[model samples]
Target: MNLLLLEDGDFTAADQVRLSGRRLAHMQEIQQVAVGDSLRVGRINGLMGHGEVTALTSSHAELSVQLSTPPPAKLPLTLLLAMPRPKMFRRILQHCATLGVPEIILLNSYRVEKSFWQTPFLQPAVVRENLLLGLEQARDTVLPKVRIEKRFKPFVEDQLPGLINNQLALVAHPGDYPACPRGIDQPLTLAIGPEGGWIPYEVDKLIEAGMQPVQLGERILRVETAVTALLARLY
Candidate 1:
């Protein structure tokens, strides 16, 4: 894991969490961490800090931590994604976390198959696993929040506004708008459509809801590639 993430109660002592429970091998193998080495650590939803490895063994390890500050501010973007199929869903979750979007909402689109939502990848544990892997790769400890919206109009009309206040909003479509802006440092709410893209009715609804329609390019892109490409361009 990048920065060892622990909840307030996860720590056994002042700074140590019981690694054997979830991440013993990660420490022992991937990191090859040694006693006396200081590692980056953070309490979930809390401060970032340093932990000194106090002890290490085959089964467990101990750390003495001192936290004084939080990790870097998360990317000020919210992703509204039409649920992709199960396989792509896994990769997208990790990509979202890795790119540092703090919130992700997976919604149903007209083209989205009803059966896709039944996939095991939607299970909370599976989603969290992918997010954690992303955090580990990014060397950050904060977890992004994920929300599912099985309905379309009710969510877009009733709920999206509050989350989008004062944010530059864009919807990724293949046609009918200027190029997606580059180097967008402002907070953004980016909506990416399904494989077949948002149907005309859905696009019009989103546009009426204050989303600025933007095209990635003439060539259609898959949901996974489009998401990463859009985020990279915005960054």
Candidate 2:
């Protein structure tokens, strides 16, 4: 883990934190930290800083921390994604956090399997666990907000218009649409569909809600790949 993330419960004092479990194991095995050694550290959804290993033992460790630096700025993007298969959903959540996506809406589409939503990975605690892994990898502290929407038409008709009202909204779909814009300076709301792509009626609904269709290329990308590619292309 690039950043040793501390939770509110980890704090023994204002400037002190106690560590155990995965973090302690990582320190003892991977980082192999010694007493008095300094390590990069950050609090969840808080500040980035350094911690000094003041005490250590087989079971736990204590660090004296000083936090001052703010976390990196999040991308000015709201991702609206058709829920992916269970097997790859965890990786996608991690990727979204690592890439600095500030908000995500897990949407439903015609092609999405109903069983995909039944995965344990969608549980609140499990989702937070994966997002934490991403934060540690990227040395970021702020967690991205994730929402799930099971009904498609209601969300598009009632809510999406307001969400995209003043934003540069686009839907990444394979067609004869314009290429995805690159390095844009405006905030965006991007919608991506399921594996076989959104059904024509769904695409029409999205267009009616204010999102213009755009294309990456002739290549059909997996949901995870499309997410990364579209975000990278946009900014």
RMSD of each: 1.9, 0.7
Q: Across residues 143-216, which tens digit of lDDT does each residue of candidate 1 receive?
A: 89999999999998988877778579999898879999999889999999999999999999888777999998
TM-score of each: 0.91, 0.99
Q: After superposition, how far is residue 1 of candidate 2 from its true place, in Å?
A: 1.2
Report the poorest 10 consecutive residues by lDDT, candidate 2.
Answer: 164-173
C-alpha lDDT score of every prediction, in listed order: 0.86, 0.95
Poorly placed runs, candidate 2 (over 4 Å): none
For candidate 2, list the clashing residue pairs, or say none: none
Worst 10 residues of 1 by lDDT: 15-24
Tens digits of per-residue lDDT, candidate 2, 1-235, equal 8999999999999999999999999999999999999999999999999999999999899999999999999999999999999878899999999999989999999999999999999999999999999999999999999999999999999999999986789999999999999999888999999999999999999999999999999999999999999888888
Query: Backbone clashes per model, in order?
Result: 0, 0
Taking all chains together, the TM-score of candidate 2 against the true structure is: 0.99
Quality of model 1 by C-alpha lDDT = 0.86
